[model samples]
Target chain A: MKSNDISLPTVPFRTRGGVRVPHRKTTSTCESIVMTVPSQVSIPMQQHIGAPCKPTVKVGDIVCVGQVIGDSDQFVSAPIHATVSGKVLKIADIPMTNGAKCQAVVIASDGLQTPYSELKPPKTDTLDEFLSAVRASGLVGLGGAGFPTHVKLRVPKDKNVDTLVVNGAECEPYITTDHREFLENSENILYAIVKVKEMLNLKRVVIGIEKNKPDAIELMRNLIKKEGKSDYIAVLALKASYPQGGEKVLIEACTGRVVEMGKLPADAGCIVMNVTSLGKLAEYLKTGMPLVTKRLTIAGSAIKEPKNVIVPIGTMIKDVIEFCGGYSEEPKKILMGGPMMGIALTTDELFILKQNNAILAFNEKDARLMETTDCIRCGRCVASCPMGLMPPLISRAVKLNEIEELKSLGAMNCMECGCCSFSCPAGKYIVQTMRTAKAMIRSAK
Target chain B: MVGKLYASSSPHLRQGDTTRKIMLDVIIALLPACIASVVIFGYMSAVLIAVSVVSCVICEYICRRIMKRNNTIGDLSAVVTGILLALNYPVSLSPLIAIGGSVVAIVIVKQMFGGIGQNFVNPALTARIVLLTSFSSKMSNWTEPFAYLNKNAADAVSTATPLADGEHLTSYFDLFFGIHGGCLGETCVLAILLGGIYLVARRVITPLIPLTYMGTVAILSLCFGLDPIYQLLSGGLMLGAVFMATDYTTTPLSNLGRFVFAVGCGLLTMLIRQFGSLPEGVSFSIVIMNILVPYIEKFTRLKPKGFIKPKKESASK
Candidate 1:
């Protein structure tokens, strides 16, 4: 499917073994509209996958937009920025969807999203300076993993990091935040690719987008050509498959490099970054604004009017849903991301975190559990797994309580992409079995 | 915040395929043969199928009730077994004797172990073997085709099957068209191939097992200095290789394991047919291969992709 419509060469790259999922990219063409500022936002201190930050502002302290209200001394942590310019309402422990409580800075908004002016774009003349700028900007992977981008962007001196892969392969169905980013913020994406490529001293930058969205792929290829860095930056059209955007899977699809088990992507001589995270980094460099707002795709069966909303971080999910014409019906289930790999929310009372890219709500019919039956030994799960791990055999190992067999079957290698369970004819929850198997192996150790 | 929202792990979405749906797909795939059986072997073949199917379903329900387990008849696996068992029977078999085969298939071979996917060996194939030993004369009493075409065709002649010898074997065209003395469904090569294609198209069964099994049998027939076309078009091999040998419960789960199992089945079937005293070997060969599924799977477990290299391999790279 080469596009000779323009002078640019369209890149078609794909890897094997991921299940095909529907792409509900209706919001891909919808330009993001800024949401009305909520009266309050409770910014959680532990948005990233690292040490939790401590709240610096107590109750009744005055705070504004882009103010660092929470900071941690740990190297892996990013500071939590105030998304709204308002008064510090309270510093309280908020319950999270994971059943743990986290410290949050609760701020009551003044209805105006005033800028936090104390910050300025730091120096990026060297590798150390660039990473420090990333950390200062409160940047983390806006993808669902919520990994701190500064740490991911940091490469060791001896690792020989060469290529930089930008993750535009939004493989999850019904989540089009990354797709919208490519369409709306193409210039910012190109700007970050050139800057990161120069700063990291990388050989080339390959932006991987799923082939389902030809518009985004074409735009990226043309944008790179227009920037006059066609040799340094290229675009890759990836096959549309569930979990194709996963770090290890994308790495294999891009360069045919295998990231070793229990090792970092840096070990494979690659650095992967999220598509939206790149745009935000470029925005931060120009405007001196930390990451306070997020682009979220709000759609599902239960949602009334779906849209691509640029809601501020820490806005309550209920308020966001209400802005999109509220629930079409009483929602039975609300997911924090796409239906495949999203975390189910106990309540809509939780505020949006930095890593959440979509909020999917489902009605009773769409959310009900399936009636399970015996596995017919169909081998569909084995064929569907991108990792090529045998799930049913691992399930049997878990049943027999064979810990060594579980370990040998590589139970720890499962990314829980939900491919096996999705393809199972018997409606068996194979991923749950893998999770339980992993837990059993861990406890036995 | 409005209601008691249910929360679980990731993957709230499902592909919505169920056990009943898969069994229904199998029944649909086997429809072409079911119709062909009644047409070729006359109305008695339909009677045999009716008795076998009713007997098996009732036996499954009663067995599950007696064992204090949930009934599995809803999945239609019992119906599938019943039809397969009926297709393996000759039209001359007594109705009471047909019920015995159904009992042996549903109760003894299937529900005794566990229902549906829990059976270790193929229930219908095993039951056909059991009946072959218990009442050999009735089980092998092959009936002539097209008895219903004549108004005064008295109790259609019982004759020697094509498997017997060169004397009874029909022409190649008649054998392929199933106009000869044989069991209800196994005589019609065209009907069975249509059903096999349907199953493969529906993604219910892969073409690997059928291709490997039939390909092995064809090559081995040539090696035995026999007419390969006659060997393939003869009794039961097409039906057994397509529907019976590919039973999910009795077969291996991995692709590699299935390949080895199908090849092994072809080897055993050819050996038994060429060397042994029995005229037919498909049922016995499948049962033998079914018993070896676990061992085949053990040797062919899938290796994880992009696995870590050992220290020695890392140094070599």
Candidate 2:
């Protein structure tokens, strides 16, 4: 039995522990503006988690929009697509914010977002055909963790999935991309849910939306009922909490089935899909276009004209920031996602990937490093940890370079939610230490 | 942007909190008690508190400089310790005793054990016990309330405390209003309750330890065929439960472990007051429980929610 001591009073179902993050969903009502295509895009070969795609196009190669520019033979990887009709400027190694030098195809746009000639909706009379169609779509989990979408959807032969949990809990502070998706693309989202439910032979579907977005929840509920899928699909209003949309936390809240350690959602008899990922799938089925344009919330304290904007994949962050009225102040930190789980980029020159849902530029006041103090053992971190990880213990293990202690403390289970660090009165960088301990554990192994 | 952009791991945003901020909250919470002590016990108690705080801060500053540690007087933990140490002393004691306890607390107990969050026991409580041992006569010279109200300037009438060896217990009204003889801050139950509420409101301390500490004591006193309310409002139980036992560095971090630590404190305190030679055992029980915190946390470690039963490698950890 779990205690929901930290849950809000209005919450119907609750998970164990999560921090109360401010919902800075400022751009939820704004129309997602279609930005002007940049002169060029630097599409990296490795957009999502898996094997890095080998570049299929070289410098001076003419490529049309939606054409496969990079692909991997590995089953786990997704193909990279050209977002603009252009000539490839260069295919070379480039350093990324994630600290990896990967092959990138720099395309010089010809000012035309022309679709590929072979673009047509593929046949999907069966599950395998549907999965194959999805595999070629260059889609991944767009909810921050860029796990391949098709791989997540491919329920194994031995297991049977009963529920499809759509993650609509955009619980992060500044990111409202999913909220806008439910508002702007309701019809397609329903289509995807019903289609996936039928294809997977799932009994029910639960779309978990945070109560912060009452408009989206009401809109989704109205759509699900108007389509007469209420019996099969339920719109759950979740309490607004940080990491409420976390895979395991959402699964448990929606389906009451825990996604235990070392197990996928498939193991727990559910297929969890991000709301945008589902919308993208339905869009691909309609227009036969692969994932090229991504709509994301461009927001933060440093952003001048913060709003949701749709830009082609691989558009340089610098161009997008410039498109969004540039910085209000000298940017001290630029992130590729929300503040909690976002990747901090040293430069604004990095290309936006398929999974990127937010581009936040923070000034020195918000991005400055905290001065660390000794652990007071206030237990705020312990109580705030969504995974029940003892960050202080992990931090202690890291300081002592104790590999075995790190393993026993389950430092690997830390999802880097930043809940502990956010709540720390001492401002101890416990999550950073856990990341260090994870690296140490891996090396020791 | 001209300046080089800073980059680090995820969760770039942090809440507005500093060690100084938290310590300041604690100091704010203790203000009621500090003022109440001065009001009830008179100008001497205020002087004692001032002496302890000043000396504790100076001792910490000098010791850190001598040991070449980073200057940590800015954290205000020494200030908190000084206040707590003075609050535990009888108002009639000399100001020199406060200075000596400051040395014992800041120099010996706190800094010697690596300062601040590194100490294994509550520094103020340890200093109190050492003072009680070294200056037994000075420590026990409890001054009655309204001692300064006597128009004639004379030495204070040293009286028996409520917890002193006697069949006559002070009235419940006197105990609650702090009209009886006891430590400066420990007598005023109302003021201490207000301070506890403030700490809880500020989120500087959780209610788990304090609730369990007093609750267990009340229940156990009832079991011992004694008046639970009389047992509660009298002595340093309320003060100890609220502030000393809930010290962040010395107690267990897990919720369940805190429950055990508080229950242990309640039980030991009751047993000592009933059977042992000491009249009060709050400090002793806390120090004993503080020593067992590492062991308590080991057994009562919060099992990660991912944990599954039927462990294959049971003996390894």
Candidate 3:
């Protein structure tokens, strides 16, 4: 055969493997409507990932919106703010969506959202003031990972942080809260970007958005152009792939730099922030308000009127679902975030947390799993794993309790993205098996 | 909500491709080759295929029953193994011999090692090797195309395959169109190519192993001053490369590992064909490579992204 007939063009960037999950962003165009204030709110004291906060207010005390109801003395935690003016009813332990029980402060709303009179904009004259202001605003990663924003943004003095990656790649299915925030709160997001740039003296800022959201990409590009800082701030359109919004993946896509294992993005001279978290931070910086109300996308097969709603933090999922026309059918499963990485809620009575961006409820037809069979060793799980770890081998290691083999396979690097399980033809719970293996490794260590 | 809600882990969605669907695709891809075999070798080919398929299924069902395992014959994997085993044998082989091969494949090679996806080697190839060693003279009897359909002829005589001796060469067109004497599935280049193309299109198997294996063989054959096209079209290279060597459980996981495995199979096949006493080497080469699959996978395991390999020694020292 002739050489010309046999030569094939090679695909570029072939190592970056990820599955293309469906973008069920039904509420992307729906304007967010403020939810009706609930008669009672049970704000959990442990919403963020670090130290859980303690209740600062006792029962029978009156609290107002923007009032600090719970605070933590630990350096890694964020304080909780009341979303409505109400009488503290009780302080009791409540079950969280992940099946953990945490102390929650319940308050009966008085129908008046009384703003705290002590609210005032902080001084932004210095870097310390800006950092303290971000911490006081009680902002964490609103993109599902509840890592405290102040802790993430604090670059060590020994390291030089030069880039700020504003993650707009909402790669999850059925979640469009970030897209809506980009469209509706564009100004605040831009303000936050500018403030962050000024505060950190960053050289470059990249806003990475998936290609599925053309309007959001266009809007962000236009905003950057209007600011006349196109050279410093650029909007990059990436391929629409699941887990493209992951911190390490985004860092690689935007900067062509890899965040080494067990290292933060700062180690690669980059600090990543979610789009919605930045918007909330900007709003707080200007209005002197903390993170109380959150914009969420209520969607999935069980939801009758799937739309975007802004509800106060700690609003019961039952009340939120009722606000969106209630369940059309019996919900077989309720998730607290996007379908891929969302936490399944055991009860609808579980309260929404600060990191919840979407609440998905699926009927029996959509939620039922297939009968699992023996793995045919098709290698689809290996191909679809974004982390490049072999889940089948990891699962085998777990079955045999081979800790050394598990470590060699890089089981600790699994972020539990669910791509392996989703792409498996045998319907194997690949991610769950990896999770078990990871736990075993941890215990062994 | 009206009833108890179901709560499990994340990833509530699936790609919806089942193992049965994948096996069905493989069977569909093999159809054109089956038709070609029947057309060239006459009704005897059809009879052999039928006997092999039925016996393999029965054997698998009986074995699974004895083992108290769920019946997996529904996945169509047993049918695939039967067809592959039948296609690898000459049409002149007796029905009893074909059934024996099916029993060895399904009962001993497949079930004894656990069913589909658990066997360390391709069941059909193993049975082919076993039959070749046990009944060499009977297994080597090749018949000319359309001879069995000739009613006026007294008897069709056994003929030598193209690979048996260079003097038994036929026209390139006859060889390419599968009118020459050979195994049922290995004769027709056109039929096997069509089936391989269908497989690649449906993505039931990646083209990596087949392409690399065939490419290595062709290059090595050219270097040895042999007619590359003849070496490729003769023997069981096409069938083994396309079907046998790509068996999922017997192959490596990573693409890099697959490349290494295919290259190793190609090298071994060329060495055996050129130096060993046997005229054909595809089955032996693939079985050997299948035995090395776990090692290949271990060495070629993909390094996780952002993983830095620790240097063994300092360069300065």
Superposed by TM-score, candidate 2 places the C-alpha of residue B16 at a distance from the truth, in angstroms, of: 0.7
Q: Which has the greatest TM-score?
A: 2
Model 3: what is its DockQ?
A: 0.63
Here, model 1's chain A TM-score works out at: 0.96
Go through the candidates in order and give each one's DockQ.
0.66, 0.66, 0.63
**Which one wins on lDDT?**
3
Task: Give lDDT tens digits, candidate 3, residues A88-132.
Answer: 999999998877789999999998999989999888889888998
A1-445, model 2: which lDDT tens digit per residue?
A: 3222222122346677898887777888888999998998888898889898999987899999999999999999999899999899998887787788878999999997888999998788999999999999888999988899888888788876788889999888989899999999999999989989888888888889999999999998898778888888888899888889988888878877766665787878878899999999998988889999899899988999999999999898989999999999998988888898888887887888899999998888888888877778888899898888888788887889987777777777777889998998787777778789889977875
Compose the digit string of candidate 2's lDDT tens values, residues B1-317: 43688887767878788889989988888888888888898998889999999999999999999999899999999999999999999998889888999999999999998988899999999999999999998898888788889877566688888888467568889888788888998989988989999999988888999999999999999999878898898899999999999999999888999999999999999999888898889999999999999999998887776655423345757
Ranking by lDDT: 3, 2, 1
Off by over 4 Å in 1: A1-14, B151-153, B308-317
- The pairs that clash in candidate 1 are none
Query: How much lDDT does each candidate structure score?
Result: 0.86, 0.87, 0.88
| Tens-place lDDT digits, model 1, residues A218-335 | 8887877777889867787887888889888887777777776667888887889999999999998887789999999999989999999998899999999999999999999999
Interface RMSD of each: 1.7, 2.0, 1.6
User: In terms of TM-score, which candidate is stronger, 2 or 3?
Assistant: 2
